[model samples]
Target: MTTDHPRTPGPRPTGATIVWAERVTKTFTTPDGRELPVLDDIGFHLAEGEIVALLGKSGSGKSTLLRCIAGLIAPSSGTVAYRGEPLTGANPGVSMVFQSFALLPWLTVQQNVELGLHAQGVGEQERRERALKAIDLIGLDGFESAYPKELSGGMRQRVGFARALVVEPDALLMDEPFSALDVLTAENLRNELVGLWEGHEAPVKSILIVTHNIEEAVLLADRILVLAANPGRIQAELRVDLPRPRNRQDPHFESIVDTVYGILTGREDAAVAAVEPTTTGGAERPAPTPTSAPLPEVSVGGLAGLLEILVARGGEDGLAEIADELNFEIDDLLPLVDAAELLDLARTEGPRIRVTDAGREFAAADILTSKQLFAHHAASRAPLVRAIVQALAATDGHTLREGLFLDLLRRGFSAEDARRQLDIAIDWGRYAELFDYDSGDGELTLDPGAQDAL
Candidate 1:
């Protein structure tokens, strides 16, 4: 873990480079003699102080790339180098944070954070001091004696982060570190991590994160590397140009999210696949179109049509039954119901759904399906609430209400102000409510109110 920091910046002079992968590739062979290519001539670079995100669906070669860079597995072809030297084995200057938060259950939080230094044969007192400093940097003060079992999920992840920081590696590799946490906690952690990266005046100069979450990628990455599966390869690279502290509700942000969503959902492929050839032509060609024409008057009457259908039906089962009666697929029903739900035009309960108080207001006002309502709901206050609920849901099962706040911190919340926000969400916002806490087992559940909100 302790390696001599390079004196000069830029590429090395000894005919080696900082980190280079020349047409790197990997293939896995099954026992049945079938060969599967996991990576195919993928190439990228990491410059000093740059944060790069590897984004794709599962089996897109993100993990394989990290492992290849770490030298855990040799590439079937291509060369990987560290500091102008070919990496044949594990590289000391690179450290990784796994998604699972791989902490030792038997070890104290401080001890777990200091394990990297311990493995390096650092003296006990020195390791303790370094570990403490790292923990304090992450705002885990006064939790030195806490064991993994006693700490919350978020706290455990913080310990994982502290351990990675204590080593002071030149490059940090994170494999979906925030994906396992709840949305609120993840957002808090993301904010804090960005702040730390901006303020750092240290030797650690580069970061590479692997994730499938489009928002996470856009929020944190300087550049996103999109990979495709079936012999994983770089499909596209997008530079996120938005300024920091990005507003999720911003129109531009929504546009990017939608574009990325399209990419992920295979909608783009479907659109491509839908192209058809012209009949009775020497060469099949696209239909000729007018260069200019008056735009057609657009109306969202379809939404009103949907609302009428929902109102005619009495309950959640009624909505589903109507959908079935009309032969509407789930996808066809989602947008209409979501629109109605967001607009307060409908309320759903278990298998029964109906119009709500706001829906009645819209109907009375004859506001048929204003485009404004769609925008308002799309960029509504619900995202923040949804973010909170998503975080709570990540606990695997139930968790103490206090544990949720701590989990947010571990995901990267500043310990200074997150507690106040948590209180507001639980006490007033109605996003979540405290149920019961057991002092003996530290187990907790959500209140009926919280479940109802969900």
Candidate 2:
């Protein structure tokens, strides 16, 4: 799509700041007694008439920061203010639209939209009128009596929008609102939303959305706040200077995407130092060594598929080029690269992801040979995989007690995190054929055939 009208910053607000977060820090104490820092010294301000997007990788605490601003959760230290007033609890003028439909399946669209009003003791007649107005405004006029299950995903999210808007909030907070929809539907919704804001039809004075999709951020927000992981903080900010109804194919838009990707991946050529490498903040490190933390939950299939693509493309491609080719954002691409590097199957430097000799060999090998090569490298190169194998060996490949591993994991990570990492390890182990897990009995045992092969 294209537009001739020049796009600048949003319309100026009449007065007062809508929301402000100052030196906000949040830390969670895990069941394992580990202090997990989610957000650290993060601060930002949202003005009336501004649409700001908080863009970051998962685990970067974007959602946490959003909740902090909404007063759904309090910061461990620091303060959140709504309109210069210390926000201690949810604001009556603020409303939220969740990513999930969060609709009552049994309730009709009109009832769903009227829920908040009903809670505030609005009369049924007034609530019905307001809900109908919102539904009509959002183009859901006829669907007021439809159930959630009968509505399409886009329609369901439109209902979410109507429900949030029915109360006429001063600010609308959306958490990845369109992520659940298909591409065309999402684009359509984005346009409708921006049109609402531009036409001065939306009830809210400002919008703050938390989203991980880079293109979506650039397309929608007046300003994009980029957050970094490992004690999430505001890493950088980029103001979108393009015209509304942006052309995705525009060189400038692609440049911004590349710049953001560079920023997130630590590529030296990236718009910043080559953007700082995605780090866990230990000793200003370089590459995954043997002692690093557990690998992310990238599938063996994903790693192998990327390696095969690189091999077919002559063993290497520029990181940004690969990202474009694979249609993956930096957050999604990094985990696959990290997983491959963890297995010594791929190496990345500067802006290039290079397939290693092992990667090429694996690409050419039969499935059986591929499995053997993967088993060897995974055992040697990945810390978690090695730990699982060693633990099994030390126990003589006999009975398995997950309690032992779970305890070890919990000592350093949160209960939820430990479980997620263990799940990733299980998938890796099974793919490498290094171990067998019986789901029925909850037993993890060394694969006797794999042991004999080794």
Best by lDDT: 2
* Model 2 Cα lDDT, one tens digit per residue, 212-289: 888888888888888877568988788777777788779888777767765565453453432344645457666542
lDDT agreement of model 1 with the native: 0.62
Q: Please, what are the lDDT tens digits per residue for candidate 1 over residues 1-454? A: 1123332323211221357677999987643454557799988776666678888765578998988887788999988888778888987778888899999889998999989999999999999999988888777888999998888777788888889888998778899998788767877777877766655523367778998877788788777777765457876667667766677667776556555544443344422322332234477655321101101111235546666665555423544356568765333454455445544567654334577755544444434243334333322323433344445555667454566454543232223323433443333222123244454663445444343444
Give each model a TM-score: 0.57, 0.83
Best by TM-score: 2
Query: How many pairs of residues collide in each model?
Result: 11, 7
What alpha-carbon RMSD in Å does predicted model 2 have with respect to the real structure?
4.6
Root-mean-square deviation of Cα positions for candidate 1 versus the true structure, in angstroms? 17.8
The residue pairs found clashing in candidate 2 are 266-275, 266-276, 266-277, 267-274, 268-274, 270-274, 272-275
* TM-score of candidate 2 versus the correct structure, residues matched by position: 0.83
